[model samples]
Target: MNRLTIAAIAVAVLLVTAASSLFTVQQTQQVLITQFGQPIRVIREPGLHAKIPFIQSVIALDRRLLDFEASGEEVILGDQRRLIVDSFTRYRITDPLLYFQTAGVAENGIRGRLASIVSSALRRVLGNEALLNVLSVDRLRIMNEIRDQVNREAKRFGVDVEDVRIRRADLPEENTQAVLSRMQSERERVAREARAEGAEQGARIRAAADRDRTVLLAEATSNADILRGQGEQEAIAISAAAFEKDPDFFRFWRSMQAYREAFSEGGDSRLLLSPDSEFFRYFRELPTVTP
Candidate 1:
């Protein structure tokens, strides 16, 4: 090869070496430098960085907050109720060197270990909590406890757990229908009891009203009978007084009333009597009228 051609090849080699030796660390990334497949150091500052071209390689990891969604896990609560829990975690790589040693350099390398730690924390914390507590305002405190426990375990994996939260929690499919049925039955029992009590009250009220109406009617009828007896007695006394005043006139007036009643319209009566009968004495001899 000529000198110009050799020099051109050399320049190309130098350019390639220069390009391989340089790397840019972004604001959102942290890089781990490895020599011959062994981690040497971690670079967290954002700027231009350099390393040996071929022997040393760089692994870039995200330093910003990352999200991990955990698969749904079934847990038994303190109340012995089974729940399927779906959770998510927010984390950051706080120690890249430790992460490289334990979890390797890839960001995905830590997922398995972190997931296990999160799951363990969830089981431990939720196992002691009742379903009511899990579903109530105390859920925030429960999540904090889970985050703290996960963080403690995650530190060994070079991850700092920022938050842990349950995205959803529900009874298992088999238990869901059972729980609903129980609730419906309970409500129905309450309604039945209420209806029975209302019926009893209504019956009692009706009984009381019926008793009062019967008593009132009986009392009114008794009072009317008493008044009618007194009126009859007064009429008898007045008639006796009128008889004492004029005995013949009273007898004649009584006979005239009897004759009118016997001959009244719509009467169905046939009387066969002798002319000398006492009933016909007024007909035979008319009583004298007194002025």
Candidate 2:
């Protein structure tokens, strides 16, 4: 064949290749075949695909999961308390045709609408719980409710919501301060009460100890008195035993004691006595023993 004729055939082949032939679908992608802007087929399987290139355009869609992290939002709880709720969700596009029909485009299509829906769901679920519950244990239930509600609305958009979860849900900073102050006040009150109770207990213990001490001291004093009296009685009994052994000596000792007591008086201190007093016998000269 001539060179000109060969070059003409190559040009025609190139034009047909560009306008009427091949397509590619990846493992993580799906595609829609549109003819004159109208969807004709949905292609999910991956690899090179053939199409009427000029008559049909292939639009690719991702089949993998996507995520959206909701920003902090103010929500009212069941107890009429306000809180900031931040959350996130995982989702996937299940039906390309339906997704395109409802959401349009791809990842960009459903995000805005999903945000609105999830926000609304947050209000609906959290509204049944107190602010503390929203910040605490009931959070999981709220997430579950959001997922269910989101999935329900997503049917028309061919989007499947896999999960919804709380990232951060908390009271506002001002409200948190208020709560802390109230807690501190309550703690201080409790501390004061505890101290007062301790003081009262101390007083009771001290009173009981004093009463015991007083009783012990009184018992000791009474016992000492009894012992002293017994000691005096014992001394008198010992003296009586000595006197029984020698009556004359005891009488002589008694007469001497009486004479000394009667005669030995100070000038300022006086005593009255008879000259023939029995006490004089010991003091005066002894009588003669005449035969």
Candidate 3:
């Protein structure tokens, strides 16, 4: 063979080799290369790569996180309240081999699968709770359950779910009015009961006080009557004793007291005396009576 032909053949062989063994990957990507329809290389770094030309091809996939979110929907909480829930999720590809095998150069399929699984988890977990549970600290527990359950199923799809978050929860328009009305009714009923109890207790206390006062007044009146009767009897006994000791003097004093009691405040004072009369004979013959 001539040297020119030998050199030309060698050059052609080198070019074919270069073309078959060359590939590229990005910083956010992982690649799998197949030779004769069999996976022969798994490249996870971002750099230039080489593969068998014509008989080998590469499948590249993103290695970054993606978002999965659900539309707003109503759910019942643990307290029998209605809640509207909106949520979102964050996930990433954890197993490139499974991801490639299952999705095969179409990450959309994995995302779609994850969406279904996560949504189902959310519905199933949230359905057991009430609106108050969703609004309060208990939501953390429910969210954890949802994330764990979704992750359990999503591992089959080559996804590692990072977190689940609820955006909003709300009550339906029709239910708000009913809830408010029920609350008002309950408050009014409680207030009325309290007021009635207070009034009833007040009336009982007043009646008790009145009964005590009546008893006190009756006792006071009876005591006064007893004292007055005792005083009158004592006065009568003293007067009788004095009259027994000095009958004439007692009669004269009694007559003077009666005259004073019967007299008016202001009237003409009249006096009539007869020296020779029998009533004045004691004063006229005082010397003889003494003798």
Candidate 4:
């Protein structure tokens, strides 16, 4: 080889070696130094890290929070009700060395272990709770409990569980239908009670209205009787006044009124009485003719 070509080849070889030895770890990542497939040291702080070129290697792990979701599981609650629980977790690798030792620095391994821990914790914690609590407003409290339990266990795997959440907790289809039917029946019962109460109230109102109507009619009748008595008294006083004005004319007017009434269409029936009866005085007292 030429001397210039030899110098360029040596420089290129050194550059490749240097590049192989140095690796940059960003803020979101961590590195594990492994020699011959065995981890020796873990570099956590974000910066440039060096390893033996071609003899030792580096495995990068995410230091940032990671997400994992376990497959949906069926669990029986304290009330003997079955639920399908789908849960997710947020965690981070706090100890890369421990993680490397436990799961060989693979993200999948970490996720697998986390899934087991979360699943076990979820079952243990939720198994003791009633189904109502699981489906109720206290669901968040149950999730918090599961998170705490999982966090404690995940610490052994060099993980810090940030939070655990249940994405869905659903009853089996048959159970759901049963519950819906029961709820519908309960609502119908309440409706019936309300309708009965309304009918009772309506009856009371109608009875009260009838009583008021009866009272009004009685009062009207009493007022009418009072008016009729007053009218009779006034009529008697008028008759007395006319008698005082002229006794003969008053008597004649009374006789004429009696005769007209007795012979009218309403009282045209014959009467059996003496001809000399005073009722015929008007007829007998006709003015004598002077022929």
Worst 10 residues of 2 by lDDT: 262-271
Candidate 3 lDDT (Cα, 0 to 1): 0.81
Worst 10 residues of 4 by lDDT: 98-107
Off by over 4 Å in 1: 190-291
**TM accuracy, model 2:** 0.63
The TM-score leader among the candidates is 4
Cα lDDT tens digits, model 3, 33-65, are 877767776899899988767888888877888
The lDDT of each candidate is 0.93, 0.86, 0.81, 0.89
Clashes of 4: 0
For each candidate, what TM-score against the reference? 0.66, 0.63, 0.54, 0.72
Off by over 4 Å in 3: 1-20, 36-38, 76-82, 173-291
| Candidate order (lDDT) | 1, 4, 2, 3
Candidate 4 per-residue lDDT over residues 117-167, each given as its tens digit: 888888898889998898798999999999999999888888899999999
RMSD of each: 7.5, 9.1, 11.4, 6.3
104: Cα error in model 4, Å: 2.4
Give the winner by TM-score: 2 or 4: 4
For candidate 1, lDDT tens digit of each residue in 1-291? 899999999999999999999999999999999999888998989999999999899999889899999999999898899999999999999888888889986657788888888888888999999999999999999999999999999998888999999999999999999999999999999999999999999999999999999999999999999999999999999999999999988988998899889889999987898889999887788556999
Clash pairs (backbone) in predicted model 4: none
